[model samples]
Target: MIGVIKALYRTQLLSIKGIWYLFCSIRLVGMNLMALLYVRQKLCPRQIAISENGISINYCTLYTQSEHLAAQLAIHCDIKPQQKIAIMAGNHNILVHALFALARLGADIYLLNTELSATQLRDINNNVHFDWIIHDPEITWLPPINNLPTYHENQISVYALLTALPLTHQMKIEITHFAKITVLTSGTTGRFKLARRSGQAQNFVSPFFQLLVKLNLSHYRKIYIATPIYHGFGMATLCMSVLLGATMFLTRRFEAPKACQLIAHNKIEVVTLVPLMLDRMLTYSETRLQSLRCIISGGAPITATLVKQVLDRLGRVLFNLYGTSEAGICMIASPDDLAVYPTTIGKPLKGLCTKLVAKESAANMRNELYIKCAWSTGGHYWVATGDLADKDADGYYYLNGRVDDMIVSGGENVYPFELQQCLSMHPKVKDTAVIGVDDEEFGQRLVAFIVLASDAEQTEAIIFSWLKTMVARYQMPKKVIFVDELPMTEIGKVDRKKLRQLLS
Candidate 1:
């Protein structure tokens, strides 16, 4: 009876602490909003803000560079407040500077994917009609546009722009409203569309609080962001690191071995990456990961097998976050949660609520997840995520797969994620992707493409025999094809579209 009372008391204390943090977060939002107006003058001179390739950029230098670039955008590029500008650049210091500069001008900045082909970029621009296109000279794929004015880093130098224009203590252009930042969804299944987010005060504070409280981001002195800056996962970490005055280490692209080396060299406390990156890092030496206090994983589905492997090799520091560009981070699975419910995506964030709505075709209790939060899009109370999920008796949610990815085989529904998870546990299988193919008798049949581990002598017959013990007869793949490597999308997800093309 005493133990039960103690446990109840602890739970109540935690709830009270959560409420206190929420109140503090809301108050900080208002303070940060006011600080946005005079952001340039609020720089800390001695603190290192960003570190890239052994070069450290202090907050004072970051402010001066951003100011100079803001002047160039107004005077040379003829850019005005509220004008639309598209930025297509890699993860570089210059790109970070441009982001702050554009924010200062209150320009609607569209962050284009650096991996997009020239044709796709043109197609997107044709529909959006951007006022200015600022691109990196290293991006050679972009075709010259005759009508729009394009500027490169060389042509628009902050130093040159500052020298040509008179020094002014006050901002030359007054921005009445904060800028709206436009981020694009990964168009794996369909064409990408813009997800516009107004530069509201709460927009910044919510993520900051979420990271600080959930991921213990504030305690980490150095952070390595391995994902692309154009995506939400990478961009959020960058912003949070800057706000906390933490040293940020960035790379133009993610290389597993190099990333591990950077973490070891810089004594990085926190490292944020997707599952694919983590899988590759696991192959390298585990000693390189000793300095890390936390490893944040998101932006893709992670299998139970991979989660277990991370815990075994790197200690219990993995955190899996589930979210989308349309809906901000909905759930977070901590290390303790994953130890019990390995596949669970954990509970909802403090201010968010989630419900499972039954899919029209699903015979089981499984349903599509609908999230309601302040950051949800579509101007509705609840945003249908289109991803199917189910909650356990303890209220931990587990993702089955996307609704569209569900396959009906012989009148039995089979989720590819389930099959993929089962196959991934096989020692011989390094990576796996499952897709449904047309079948005259069953309506649709599952096909799996697998990448075998190095020096593993497993054949198709052996894998099939092993899988029989792992999954149900109907859940097993109708056909298994071995591959050298799985095709990946620009954002590091399995390219199912290209995989289907390979089948054809």
Candidate 2:
């Protein structure tokens, strides 16, 4: 009850005036008018709502542009409500407009990852059977599908649509169907799975409130989403920023220096990024990031070293968010929580149920984490996160890497993250990742990939000797491969799959 009160206060929903305004806004949005127009009257016409890739658009322009774009889609493409359409593009103002436009048309939207291969895109299309595909011109490798209408940016003419007058009223398009949005899984280790969610504002209340109270998102008016919008983390921040009436700074791709410039120039108050991006951004000057009040890091694990660096350099402003594509957002560790335990993922959010399921015989060992939440893909039953975790006495959760990524060598289970964490403590080691491979004798053997510090002259023999002191003989990696750098996923996680392929 107290948590609810605090969330309400922090989100400005506790005051009578705030409640009344919210009530009015909800009522207006619930009416037959387009949903994006809810902010048309609330915000100033000249207030920039989106700034992406040198393009700035105010709320009025956003509404008008989306409306015009929706009309064009309806007239030219014969797009109808409930039709499943996939959008494959990076972050841009046109993509934002298309999202709003598609929402108004009540289309089942699938946000495709920009990093998807031609074959992966085809596989998704085979299952989804999309009515149309709207992609950017830069996506040149998209395979041609039979009877699937593909429209590039040039064919659509976004600038002309943005400059055109609003034709929604004249078009007389009746919006009776609500939309459902789907985001693809990271597919770092395996095939991609579609995580679906209802597009209603009511469905997002719990997660939004949790983030509002926990991250203090209501205070931030300038937000920089430094990750791909196709991913769940980026999509969530995009919706929340819009609901908060905040200005969003988006980029087609995340470049460390460019991100620093945007944040520094605009005085960006909050930023949503993956840990890899955060680490890269730290390589630049700290002065460029001084304006940040909240740095929301998610979509990948935040290493202890990264946590220490953030606290030491940026102060206590880093917030670590943990969730899966299937589960919206389960836990968030604040700066204070990290200060206490840098490895903790914090307590579960309000109204969320989390448990670690272990075997009856191995009750003391780490087990898979299960989450039951209103916003997750699992409606009522608990969903297995596939990631192994254990909770501390204080209810903070610590991840033990992916369950599939675990190695069973000589009848003993070995978690790669534990070995990686231990190996990273060496002063000469810059970065490291661990993977398991098939061994003729041990069934599976651990392989460690290392990136050494620039000034260090470290050898595999020295590191192996050092690691022997840290872990048991079975837990020690069979081989230590030195590399210039590790391959990273689109969201910045070390691509273990790629590492395994390197062995092949």
Candidate 3:
């Protein structure tokens, strides 16, 4: 008994020492290394920065490869500082390297959505007038333009370029301003606009520090980013992983089963994704998802039903982040908040303020949410979100769909989200979207596009009957359209405008 006690004591002492050593290392070396990457453009020569598909690349090699490519761009491409360059590619090692290399060269970079068609791409370029286009070889749909150079991903392969470059430490370039990263809006409603980021340290520091404190982010060392890196949510997660000295696991595409497998295989502790990804992932057995401790869902409004399902299946790990391209992450619903108010977007983050401007009626108290944060556009104190929301007595905010999405049927206001929540409760419904469409009688009528569960046969009459029990008569969808799948934006929100276009 005495021997066992002594052994246990020794083991405890060793564990404590190990923790102290790790804490010291992270504070002393890890933080300095990250700062060096941002300020001095110096990469950690020996520390692993990124890992994908069981392959890893240290910061030194990543920097060297980026330097080689930057040199080539400077010589062959004649790309200069502050010139607008558009990059259209899927998430990969090449994309990561290109982002850093262009930043070092001080170019204004636009990360175009990979899902854009040739016509859309052309339209965007015609409006923005990019100086150069760097795209993946798979993007053959891009139209040719006179005197404008297009660099293919295969041409600037980091791995291939690294093999040819001489093994030597290259001097770091001093960029006065980090490359301004421009992300295009989802364009689900109408024309897409550029949302530019200055890439300043001060802009990210406050929110990042708050996130670290509130989300307990240090606990998550291995992260899997399931969203497209071109989007703000995905990009933010990537930057946070680098800042925290965490290992990241990424794939070019997101498949539910594959995502689950990757999470389990890689022991991914944190997963940042949209609600659609979570819904799809939950279709599989929960036993496959043992390693995930936190799931960050954002980029769209998640239904309460879906939130409950996630908590039940995946434990209380769902955290909903609410924000837009114009306004960065303003509100974040922690697991505790979700437990209390399932659909609440939670309170404003530190250094952020929110107010509701009543547009319709003061009695109703539902208003458009206006926010002011460090990341707001044009340094405005109050940036209009164009999204309608309701705040409870407890200060939790509930999104009531977009302001434009509200439909008035027979002189009664009907929010599509109310109908959507009602429809989502139906066990037969796999996915659902509600939109307002023009009507000859009513100013606008509600239309519901629903994807039913596999092997579940339910007629429109039955669904309408079920919905009648939940929502008001005026809120009933005038038309119920059955679809194999609803149109989704790149970030996984239902594309209401696209659905209306299809109906038209």
Candidate 4:
């Protein structure tokens, strides 16, 4: 098996020649580390940047890069020491360098998501000027960007950092008045949570990519980030990659077949994926995914079947981590955990705390999972989360569902999330969600709403068999209703309440 794996890997590597021409444009990016790298080591403020070639970030290099960025600011945007700017692009190496330069120059940074519609952008722009809007040139439909003043950067958002870079010691500003950063929460729950960190706030937690590089997990020179950078998961991956000194391979658009080629050719490591994306990759390839050291899974829950399929088909490098924008990484399921309990989301990360709170009441032990951490962000721009959960005697927290989606069925509790996760595993079920319907016999009945793959109808018997084996009798959906798509919020989380209302 090992020999076969090696032979197959060789075949995949050779196929990269077909795609090498695509990465030729990477030369357009230049490094300009001047004086910005210098910082108090006690603060540990200097975040590291790594490349597939090797990490070239040193004190002198970082310093030079900072100085060069400061020079760019004077040459480009006339920035005042006290002024703040917002960066509206996904993760780019230039963006990270820009953040470092911004900190050195005392300019505020606001991280904005690219998915916001024009009306939504208008509301956000009202809060602040986003003085500079640097984005993947591919995001062409930005009506909000057209509303902002012109910036000097091209394609990448590096210019945002350059505009804020020039004010080193030239213009003095108070420490309290340095750049502030806002990370919009990935609304896993019903509502959005906005987290605001002060210009000098140390609340931002560094991601784990640096630790992975220091440990030499793999020889991946390029970090493949196909997800949206504005999301917390994508931002964390990008931040960690730059700090680890990896060249970020970004896709203006994500396509599964093309993503496969990048992974094999660039020696990409640490590819962050959402469950749906993973499903696409599994559908695209039948053989082992080549050259990937750690395919980190997060963003949403993956069913046990999907987990098993990825592990068996791809190599043993699947690292599953429990996530929330609010609490950081709560738990990590390593390769060993996948071998034992393929479905488990793993144990909590060092600083986070995990608990499962009952959905109905305190005595109701069978509830979804809830977690608390010192790092648990208080609120997203002061918006709180309404996720329901439960905790066990051993501290293993299992998710019940969203508190808002709770269905009281014949005095029994129903969590739409758990049912949805289970139903999504069916081969015929491209996507599935459970919603409560007003029933006369059982206060509420579980109803499954599905959008099948290829529009090919699947057998209810097979789905019933799978559900009977995976869930309890009462936990199962009473009726399976096929749909074109499940209701979703602006941030991409399933809207159970909306689905329930639709069914009603």
The candidate scoring highest on TM-score is 2
Q: Which lDDT tens digits does candidate 4 get at residues 211-238? A: 3432243255456776666666776665
TM-score of 3: 0.84
List lDDT for all candidates, in order.
0.73, 0.77, 0.73, 0.56
**Better-scoring candidate (TM-score), 1 or 4:** 1
> What's the TM-score of each model vs. the native?
0.84, 0.90, 0.84, 0.67
Q: For residues 440-500, could you state the per-residue lDDT of candidate 2 as single tens digits?
A: 9999988999988777788888988898788989988889998887787666667777888
Q: Which digits, one per residue and each the tens of the lDDT, describe model 3 over residues 1-504?
A: 344334323323224543454345334323222233432223224566677777887766666666676665655567778878888776777777777667667788888887787778888888888888777666777756412223334454433443455536643444435558888885433467778877665677677666775677766668888888888888888787765556768788887888888887877889998888888788764677777888999988887778887888778888999987865688999988998899899988878888888887765455899988777665657887878888899989988778767778889877887788778878898889888887889888889999998899988899888887788788888889999877666566666667888786
Which residue pairs clash in candidate 1? none
* Alpha carbon lDDT at 394, candidate 1: 98
Give the runs in model 4 whose Cα sits over 4 Å from its true position: 1-77, 80-84, 90-104, 125-178, 186-190, 198-220, 286-288, 362-386, 389-396, 407-413, 424-431, 434-504
Candidate order by lDDT, highest to lowest?
Answer: 2, 1, 3, 4
Error of 2 at 444 (Å): 2.9
Against the hidden true structure, what lDDT does model 4 obtain? 0.56
Poorly placed runs, candidate 1 (over 4 Å): 1-43, 138-171, 362-366, 407-414, 437-444, 469-475, 497-504
